[model samples]
Target: MHPLPAILIDGLRATLFRHPRVSATTVGAGMFVAVVVVYLFASILLEMAGTSPPWMLLPGGVLTVLGDSMLTLIAAWLLAVLAARREAVWGIATVLLAATVAAAVVVHWPLGELASYLVLHEHAGLAILVELVARCWWFFVLLVFAHWLAPRGLGHALGSAVLAYAVSAAAWWWLPQSPLVRTMPVVQATAEPTSGDQDGDAKTATEQDEADDDDAPGAKSEFDAEAAMYAQPALLDAALARLKPQTPGKVDLYVVAFAGDAQQDVFRNEAEYVETLFAQRFGAAGRTVVLENNAATVTTRPLASWTNLQRTLATIARTMDPAEDVLLLYFTTHGSDDHQLLVDLDPLPLNQIGPDDIADALKTTPAMRWKVIVVNACYSGGFVDALRDDSTMVMTSARADRTSFGCGADSDITYFGKAFLAEALNRTTSLREAFDLARTSVDAWETADQKDAKPDAKGVAGVEPIQHSEPQIATSASIEAKLAAWRRTLHESAAVPFAPAGEAMSRGASPSPDASTRSGKG
Candidate 1:
């Protein structure tokens, strides 16, 4: 085995636990040397991860580490003075140094690097949570070792443990960051080069290639992300401005369509198609705004972030009368087990919207007294409990514990999205009637697919049925009447056609127009 790993393993076996194996013997110079070495190694791990947009070593970082070392030594000295009458001072110091060395090698190795990997993905919040848990473990280790080093039979070990936590606190605040390193600020000077700056573009491209090779994955495409983020404010403002004012005395229906999870184009396709459906069939022309998290729409349509959703909802509320206007929010995304709508556009820290976010956004406006929220994602029925109210109609793609299908790289729309928006809503504006139709269609489609599904390559099982995704709906009596009234105002129109996003709109461009007016297009 390599000497470095061999030594690390030895340290872990001896001093990594609550009761360290090392004796309260003399504090050797070599023990202190080992402590310093392990600390420097841990610092290297933190600083290296920090620098990949990644953190870089700040000036005086070593000074902070040195100060931490000094605190541990000073703490040991104080405990020795109070307990051992200076007789076992070196022994106490030895135990502290041994504990420090073992803790560093263990806690910051697999654990520290894991946290840093999340940081590379722009998930610093998760890293901080990890660091907090690490801090707690660090304190526990210190407390146990302090009990071993304190004077025997004196019962002063508890106080010694408390003092040991001071050392832990000093280590905690400065460990991940330290006098050490900080994340690099994103710069806005990375826009694409103009025709006149071709030579500059070439140079920049070469520089980017070097950076890509040298730094971690987090470093690459950072500039592109910065430019994209810099352009969002304008894109969001434009989307908000496009919302037309409410027609007088009519129960105006405004739509906010959100497409999350940029990895799959199915979500974006479903959102865009629904936008066309509501505008052409439902007479909500000029009263809809789309927010999608797609690589293509980053600069055109506002990214579907919780903050953007709130802003869009607030603007829509103000545009229409609070007493009678109805808002329809369509969400198409991949859901997690815990029911969070995945709001992801890589290298951009977009906030994930959970069930509670819906109610919070509505409360802020308090304008859309009537609403129909359709969530077309797996496990989306979990949102019904959080969002359902007397004046609101909530519909979900699947039960809280079930999974919905038809959303993937090859899919143009999810099963629930197609049935609810592309089929049901296209045929009838009554949300209640549409949900019933879509539900039946979804159940039949799922049942037929399960029967036709082939077995695994091993072919161990015969044809059997799969569990169904029981779609859920929460209807409001008041909202139903308002929707019925609004439907009366909608112009006579043909059922909107069902076309995949790719067929309906070209990538990186908005849909040309509502082509659903033609008869029998559905």
Candidate 2:
């Protein structure tokens, strides 16, 4: 009834020449006849090649050919049906081949043996020979003649027959000998207990329990003690505290997670975990804002409308203090081409966020001091080109043209985010060291699946000390001061000359600044 099945039937009919080639009716009829005839001939040839005999030859060969023809027809019909249903063509072809081989093994071996016995003992070869001659020469030949007599010619039908023969031959050569080929079933019979199957029942129950445990959410918690410890609030607190200055007032932490689809639960979970880390590390005496997909209140506006994001950025720029000692921003979401961040909108386009938009947002907050932005998404390295400044440090999950994995719908978190946060919290590692470890972990995880996922950091240049009026107070020894010093050194090591507007515009080159010499004072 479907168009695909109709097309298939019409094609075969036209090829067969039941109707005239030029005439509409004969065109459809000819194709059907061609496919059927070709398939039959190919099946017969394959069976004859597989088995040959003098005593068992005639009748056994006839029956084998008949059975194989039927099986091939059924397989072809199944393939057509699947095509009609809009299934993948290649997958349907594979399944059809498998099914046909199974049916052939089941029907051929026993029938061949029986026919061989009949031919040897009772001389049934004469009847089989008569039937074969009648079918091939009379019936099949007549069918072809009738098709050719239609308004259309037999050329199309002959071509179709040739194609069918080629397909069948290929299938025959490639079909493997499976369990169905064996005359007897291969399943082993187990001894049944009479009202005393306690051990068996217990084993079955235990297996079921294990399967359930494996399927349960948070099941990994039972096995991964390190993940559990790393996720704890106390550990995060300790890690952040160890890095904080003794005279800390309020460190502003901003977390934003944009999961484009409801299917992207892994990104959502990673965002939540990261939020917990931020709260544990900076929440004691600092300001922390967690913006996730489901949260009632979010500082980062929903990207359902790009204008909302713009408004949110404007609000942050208006409210944020220019002299804030530290500002941390994290974003987890899908990414697009050329390393653009993808916002989850109703009709999501790939790589919706451009580098220009991010650059514009950063430009709005030019007065902020000691800014750190960590982006966990594919091709995130592009963000460096947009957000990198003398005072900003950027970490990205992967370079352009690479995919970051482990954020499937069912997965709780991505490999990059989980590894980065875990190592940062539990290993007492610097941000750079944590980024390196995260990259290694992500690489290993992706490698298992034959994928390459790597993370990179940029913007270790143009960093300088905050020029406050109280230089002595600002230069006091503290963990924050030590981290700033390290960042400054990294910036110095990676520094390049910063060309002004005219030269930069003419050259069309990226802005490069000596980070250690960069003045934090506006």
Candidate 3:
């Protein structure tokens, strides 16, 4: 056998509690170089072995191995201190380094893949069992290594092994998020037409999406934002053109829903839900325009922007009798402490909307008389002052000085979006009543989250906890009466059930709205 292979075989045997001929004096700086080479090979292999193809390789994956190496060195030093053998630290480090790599390749990738496959196949119970077994086996490997190296006792060796595993895990979990170290490459794969479709008659997935109905919630397709940005004007025009011309003498309702933050899918989900909810339940079919800043909808829906909002408001004013039709303006996104809506989609230069801009836009469009603007964002109460008027009703998610919860990648909808748009609005037509119910629901959720929140290591001892976001509302008697008259015109109907984009779009079985959203966390 080759010398390197022979050394690795001994190291693997040592991890399994088998004795080897390896000596403490023979382990030296050469072992460190071997460890580095092995780690690089293993990480590169793991990177290419993801469930999804075209996986981006993170170069800073080396940081993980470096962290593990340092932790192993520390553990060996601690064990040497306990055994009163300063000279034996290098030997212990050498063996433990090789054992850790063996554990990584044996336990992490192979067993982890089995557990993930079980999970993907909907065998979550089996997956959990496999994960538990994998963890036990990994710990056993480390414990065996420590027991052989520490002369003091099993107790001291156990502590050293625990420290090694804990520090290694912390490094693995947190280092990926470090912007300074990780340089992730974007993997874009190009595929040529196959022999069966050499004539180019087959449609690409994107072309198929465009050929399908945009109203279908399940017809989501991804596109390059920067390249497709020029299509925004035409997309907006097409959406507006689909609207049924306003019938004379009927108290019509026109909806302009804006989801301004593309970073969180929660905003996009909320916007999609609102579009379906208004069209199906609120008697606004062919009269709603949804502007979203999401990656999935960039090609299908008009990108949410300051310019688009102006065009939409102007077009709606021209379509409806400004004095008679009711307009509901819905805005969902992150807010700055200074009160600006975060309008963004990467590589697209979009401007953020402020309270003054909103007020000014509506102010210039003199024909939009009865207005109800809903702002679902942190620190949105600041908009109330600028938006309040006799003909406009302003509803905000949080106080000017406070923050709102439930807006992130994990959440399907914001706390306010779920309570107001999904639950309360479904049950009641009265805006005031819906706001009241939603406020109660939001308060309950925020309170529960507060109690469950754990103070992390970085938390200051005396710092005050985040307070409850008090949802604010400014109503107009005139607009309420107009809305009430429109409510009287609607045919009596059952409450529309809420669903997120995936589930709701799947069956297409409901007589009601099909956009379904998940619960909690923005």
Name the lDDT value of residue 448 in candidate 3: 75
Clash statistics: count for each candidate: 4, 30, 7
Query: Which stretches of model 1 miss by more than 4 angstroms?
Result: 1-223, 462-465, 506-522
Residue 155 in candidate 3 has what lDDT?
87
The lDDT of each candidate is 0.65, 0.38, 0.66
Q: What does the lDDT read for residue 280 in candidate 3? A: 81
Task: Report model 3's TM-score to 2 decimal places.
Answer: 0.54
Candidate 1 lDDT tens digits, 1-522: 543344444345434544544444544556565656676667666445433333445565676666566666677677766565476555455455445556655564445556645543445467667756665665555555556555364356667766656654544443422225433322222334322111121112123223222222212222367877777778877777778898888888899899976766778888888788888888888899888877766666788886678678877866886556788999988665456676766767765667766665664322356788998876788899888877789999888877677875567778888888888987787889989999999999988876676777788544345557789999866678778899899888888877766567543436533111000000
Write model 2 residue lDDT over 1-522, tens digit each, in one string.
Answer: 543344444333332323212322222333434434443344444344432221112233334433444444444444334224323333222222322332233333334444434432333454355323322321222234233432244654344333433344334333321110101111112223212111111111113123222332322222233433233333223322223232334434333333432224454456545544544543322333333332211112132222333334333433444234445666766554344454432222212444554543443322344556776665566667667654566777766434455554355666677677755444532566666677677666554443231333663323222111110001112324434453442211211222222243366532211111000000
Sort every candidate by lDDT, greatest first: 3, 1, 2
* lDDT score of residue 55 within candidate 3: 34
Q: What is the lDDT of candidate 2?
A: 0.38
RMSD to truth, every model: 19.4, 29.4, 25.3
